[model samples]
Target chain A: MIGKLNRNSTLLSSIISIILGMLVGAIAMLLSGYDPISAYGALFSSVFGSASDMGETLRTITPLIFAGLAVALAFRTGMFNIGVEGQLVIGSLAAAFVGLKLELPPVLHAIVALVVGALAGAIWALIPGLLKAIRGVHEVIVCIMMNWIALFLSNYMVGKVLSNNSDSTEKIHPSASIRVDFLTDMFDGARVHLGLILAILTTIFVYVLLFRTKLGYELRAVGLNPDASEYAGMSVKRNIILSMMISGGIAGLAGAVELLGTSEYLAINPSLPGTGFDGIAVALLGANTPIGVVLSSMLFGGLFNGGSNMQYVAEVPFEVIRIVFAAIILFVAANFVKQLGNRKNRKKKGEKASA
Target chain B: MLSTMTNLLETTILYSTPLILAALGGLFSERSGVINIGLEGLMTIGAFTSAVVAINTGSPWIGLLAGIVAGILLALIHAVATVTFNADQTVSGVAINFLAAGLAVYLVKALYDGAGQTPVVESKFTDLAIPVLKDIPLIGDPLFNTSPITYIALILVFVSYFVLYRTPFGMRLRAVGEHPHATETAGVSVVKMRYVAVLISGALAAIGGATLSTSIGSEFSATTVAGQGFIAIAALIFGKWKPFGVLGAAAFFGFSVALSLTGQVWGLTEYVPSEILTMLPYVLTILALAGFVGRANAPAAIGKLYERGSR
Candidate 1:
């Protein structure tokens, strides 16, 4: 029982540990001849400095929000959808194809592109989900493999089948591009676009769906304990597949937004954007909640944008951000373990005392 | 058609070396209930270390040892996190990946004097032709004449299979993965077994990375491994995590890459986009995992955090 309390205290200690970690990092920076305060000031100011910086930060957060939501949703249902990267890639390709080929009013075209992208993502994700539900293959292995396939397939399509005048897809028609003029005017020329609004709406939708709907309940129940849910007469298999598909669709939307709103076309060597993998960190930090994912995504976005600027101005390597991210993950994962251990210990103690 | 076959065989040997080694590494860790998702990162570290060492020492063999040592040290970190501290296996694995990547790039810039890549080593592993075997019509040149790593990879496959299925240590490792409590009752130390498994995983993965630098490229770049470690994981699952099965899957993937590269040489690109051909291996891997490989049952307690006094 004493051991349990100590374990629980570890969670509290983790918080203290994180602060200590920052101090350690600060000391190291000082020893390295860097002004920690100035570096941090630059990081924050570059992220929230001018309106333009803020706009770029928001722009970076847009896809992260969608990817984070995708990961979080699957996580909530006890599924590890590592294939979000693949889903995002395929989704973006689908959106870019539609944006370039389709002719419609601006609003309708954007909607169509986004929908197509989501549907493409859902379809790609559904394969692994169905396999897990019906055949008992683990989603982790399946998702990771699918991500690679999606990457190669998208790269191939953009470089070959969908190639326009260049080694990339044709630029989307004016009607298909998301209007960033408002953001441009607001920031005196920033790249933020309507994707941010869509991301927010999706967050609210995810929150409501997870907390308010019967489907959400079933999904969560299945995630918590599949056998228990089955004993309670829920179709665990169907729910698992559904959760994966929905998550995939959300990830797909992230890709679509990136292509249509940000890049305006698909480049053959489109930088992986890292949105899918970053979503993993975001989801974990957010505790897999809608609001949590949104906030976490923003924080990550800030770090990314700030890190880039730090590279440019402070001569700090952008890789430092990765180390920071890893440290945070280590800190949080350790805290979670401590909390679980403490809870289990406390439960045991309470039972023994009552008996 | 004959030339195509020879090219395919050569490509298969080239592609399979890393996959086979990495999958063997994963087999060691996962069969003992520790999921080593850091295989990719470990491979990257190994590749970077070997590249640098070879450049300095002018000996690919020394570089190989360096790679393995680096891998073992990194694996020790994972062992501490998952085995000693009982951290979440998946997240810790992911953190290791990030740390390895960040550290490698940072060190490369710092140690290599701001070059994002290592100096190309003159002492690369050379392809060896088995005298008589090399004379065999089509099969000899492609399969028999290869870098030493190919021979090591092939031998390791059987060795791994024997270790996992036919050895006492293998039984204990399997026992721990399947039922730690029962294994403990039987007088086995679960933590010790897991630590060993994870370290072996690291060593094997690093060998794969070293092979890449010494045999294939002779230098290390940021994206050197390029998610091949994850691909090995996929191959492992698709092969049902068996040594021979993984070999087959790796070879299958190798064939795809080989075919794609060969397609360019064969002028097949005039009809089909080379990019489409390049997508074949990844596409096939997904398909295999989704259904082609059938159902794969992971070890019980695969990712659970084991507590000493829980029971």
Candidate 2:
């Protein structure tokens, strides 16, 4: 069927684009007065160098997978959720606030903190979603504005609201931490925690929610053709809002996972975390699929983990990896361009045949 | 009291020039049926190029030219991806932002052996005071004693208005944005018009970037341009895509930034955090979009790729 063929091509295109991305990175390094092969070699060796290094890579990938799924879910529903950065910030702040302040049993403490964080993200996303559904406002503009607001507000909270007269808060209680003793021992005292296991489980949950549920079917239907979906007795507006809330909640959960699993305290960020923005690249390279997002995120995790080693051994900047990610998106979107041309040509041929 | 008012006026003008130039550039591209969210990246390219050239050549003029060229080159890549290949404009724009940030920092480390800064330039664009005009009561000193780009930015608004409404090229460009099929039927190539528009945007945006390095007392750093490009987009929408309207919007946003910077001297920072003060422009922008502008009509085919004989 045409649908199956299209899906295969999309998957094929994602793989090809990633290779192109690496090639582009290599060429960029060569031009910048560095040896491409050695830079990449140092990069891989550092990623796989030791158990602690691998644990660090997994820690980084854990947040990325959650954020990537957040973006991919929105992409499948035809909404561009550019506010993931803002959502994640609020989510983390909420988690940190509750984890440090609340008193409860150990497991209950962690659960409450994560739920509150996800709820905060959902509430933040709810504003733009509601505006888009009810008032016909563009979500992109609203989200961009909200991003700055969140950045400022969170910075304020960390500095003034929750601070014990310092810029950063005290660490959260041990009861709320997600670190697992066995995992840390296995990785030789690495900061690897239960967050990785949670991330994998969330990935499976998202996959099922997207492809194996009636709500998922309706959400896709609305995305493909809102008018048809509306005629078929679906509430297009409700689905839009629901999809955005779910997307935001996942991004919020990413914030909780990262905070409880690793740092255990929120520091005053000089800028918004790059994890949310990087998620867009991960989603695009994965072709917006659950399994694909995990695999692609692992590759990205390795690259970032190895970036410092590349810098240390080969004198190549870590920015070279950022450039490579940008290149991959460019090549992947290039397929959309080619498809546009083909669609027009086919339409022309069809008209001619009818005449 | 009069001195404070004049000082505020001067800062507002200084803050608004880059924004005005960038918004005007966005006006041209969006009017021609292409949504260029990469104006920020183009401005970054412009800022970095100008600063480096000015530092080496010791001439701000030559640096300005190099900055413009850098912006054009980046815009060309965007055009190839979006206009030729029919890529998603927003995604392409985001890519450009990443590419510009990474490449600029990478080159800075390579060339300067620093984290992400260029060497300070010896020559900067100096402010010029008009002889008689600068002495006129309250507005004179602030309005007349500004750099060359300030005057040029104001002139560009009128010039864009003239070209967009009076010239044949402008008509075709607008026509393409509203209805590409009509423009194609009338023998204008929609693709060519869009390419030209996007390139013009790049040139103007680069000049905006140049102002940051050459006029503002700051060296080129990773955060030099900040989010000015996005602010320019906000201005474009606030102005409802009109050249004069964009000028007004840019000035208003610029006023907010000026207030934030000078709030400490003005004693307003005591009541508000600088972070919150810095967020005023963005907050106002959101309010402006949510029904304050009444009705905003973007070019119908703004984000769509043109195809022959297709609706």
Candidate 3:
């Protein structure tokens, strides 16, 4: 019972860490001579003041949900897929390519574009996964390299081939769009689309696949103790590949959603979309859980969407929001470190008593 | 034709200086069992700090020192998180990276009343010809007629090789990375060694960043460091984490950069797309990482948190 209580306290402690993260940001605001209260007020008002505001927030949440789910799934499988951003760019480009090039029927066009986008993401992730499994290369290094490669590849594709003389590709066909007329009308002509529904359903599907399924058991088992799982006859290599592919596919879906539901064109991006990097913070804050990821992603989406208002009203730079996000990750990691220290002390005490 | 060859060599040398320094920095930290993925962030801070200071103090040398100090400050945060609190190294690294990028931009806004970049410094580390070497045949102009930072970067490679291989402290550093338990049993402080290694890494990486702002780019922008720090990390891995190997890998990467830049200068831009040329170095890095070239092993306890009195 005490052990269980201790675990609950740790969860509470994470909440406290989050609050502390906000406090740190507030302190920074104060140091910059900006009123924290008004800043936060503006932030909230921006995200929740109107239906259209909520629509914008939801639009931001759509991709974040997919990206966060991608990170969470991979984290649970004990692989840090830092290549999510790269995969996302690849996936978005693929979706854009298909959406622009293909002449499929309306319903079939959108589906095929999304599927192909996910396929491209999976293929991009497979390089790192296979390298890690077969060549003993660190996934982080490979992923970092691949991220740049993807950027360049996407830039090249958008500039040389798909582009209609501009740096961005031609507008994707309307048939391949994920826009919903009723939803757009409901949001007062806001940019919200069917991607929100798709994101929520993907979250539910991911949760079920992670918890209710046998494959999840093997994956989780391998994550916990790969050596033990190997002894139990699990193919760790195959699972690593599969986990990365799934993670990449989900990240790819985020790209497709962003393209089909929002932009409808692929632009030559000099830098990453940053959604995938944001997903790391989301996964960390969410404790790598599906429901937790959705909640935390919503919070982050609001922060991002509302940052502009905070900037306009409070005269605080939008960069402060990024600092706050960093602080949150920092405090959480610090809390984790403290917990690790406690566990080590307890283990030492147990050993001493045994001796 | 000879001049073009010399020009390529000069460009390669200039480009490799920062990579060499940053890779050498990463070598020290990872060798001591802490992965410093925040190299990019550290470099950014360094670039920003050095540029701002150089503008204020009117001395590139002072700016260089300021950059090193800034790097050490950030590295100390990482060391505290990883060594004291025993946080996950990579996550901590990511956080540090984000913090640096954000903090640098925030500071730029605070100090300069704007974001995106710092004011340009008038004083930069310009290239100077060596007394006698500049007059020599083919090699002199490229090899010796360079900025002081280039010389420092090259000399430091040997200096790091000596300190990391020949010194007693180096042995303990390697031992702690491989077997901290044994090192602790031998009365060496694992935490202190790790702190020293991490701090050194920060200093060198900062120097690399300072070199960029002070000489290479002549100013500090939000994208000044870009992905060079990561490329340095890849170079370090490709070099098998050795000082001389890092020098070679940095040069190789530098050569690729020079080649891409040269294509346009040589009026071959229409023949080969600059984007394709730009993609070559990254593709090579991925291929090298996939063991298409060879293999390199990391330190045994590279990412592990050392706990005292544990099995």
Evaluated with lDDT, which candidate comes out highest? 3
Regions of model 3 farther than 4 Å from truth: A1-7, A336-355, B267-271
- Give one clash count per candidate, in the order shown: 0, 0, 0
Every model's DockQ? 0.54, 0.64, 0.66
Task: Go through the candidates in order and give each one's C-alpha lDDT.
Answer: 0.83, 0.85, 0.88
Q: What global local distance difference test value does model 3 have?
A: 0.88
Q: Taking the true A–B contacts (Cα pairs closer than 8 Å), what share appears in each candidate? A: 0.57, 0.69, 0.63
Q: Which stretches of candidate 1 lie over 4 Å from their true place?
A: A1-41, A164-166, A270-272, A336-355, B1-4, B129-131, B269-273, B286-295, B309-311
Classified by CAPRI criteria, candidate 1 counts as medium
Which sequence of candidate numbers ranks them by TM-score, best first?
3, 2, 1
lDDT for each residue of candidate 2 in A295-333, tens digit (9 for 90 to 100): 889988888889877999888888888888888878887
Q: What is the C-alpha lDDT profile of model 2 across B97-137, one tens digit per residue?
A: 88887777778887886467887877989888889998899
- lDDT, candidate 1, A1-355, per-residue tens: 9977864575456455445445544554565556767766777779988898998999989988999999999988899887788899999999988998789997899999999999999999998899888877778777777777787778877776677436777788888888568777897577888999999999999999999999999989998999999999999989989999999999999999988888898876533556687888888777788987887788779988997887678765666667677666766766644656677999999999999
| Model 3 chain B worst lDDT run, 10 consecutive residues | B110-119
TM-score for candidate 3 (chain B): 0.96
Interface Cα RMSD per model, in Å?
A: 2.6, 1.8, 1.6
Comparing 1 and 2 by TM-score, which wins?
Answer: 2
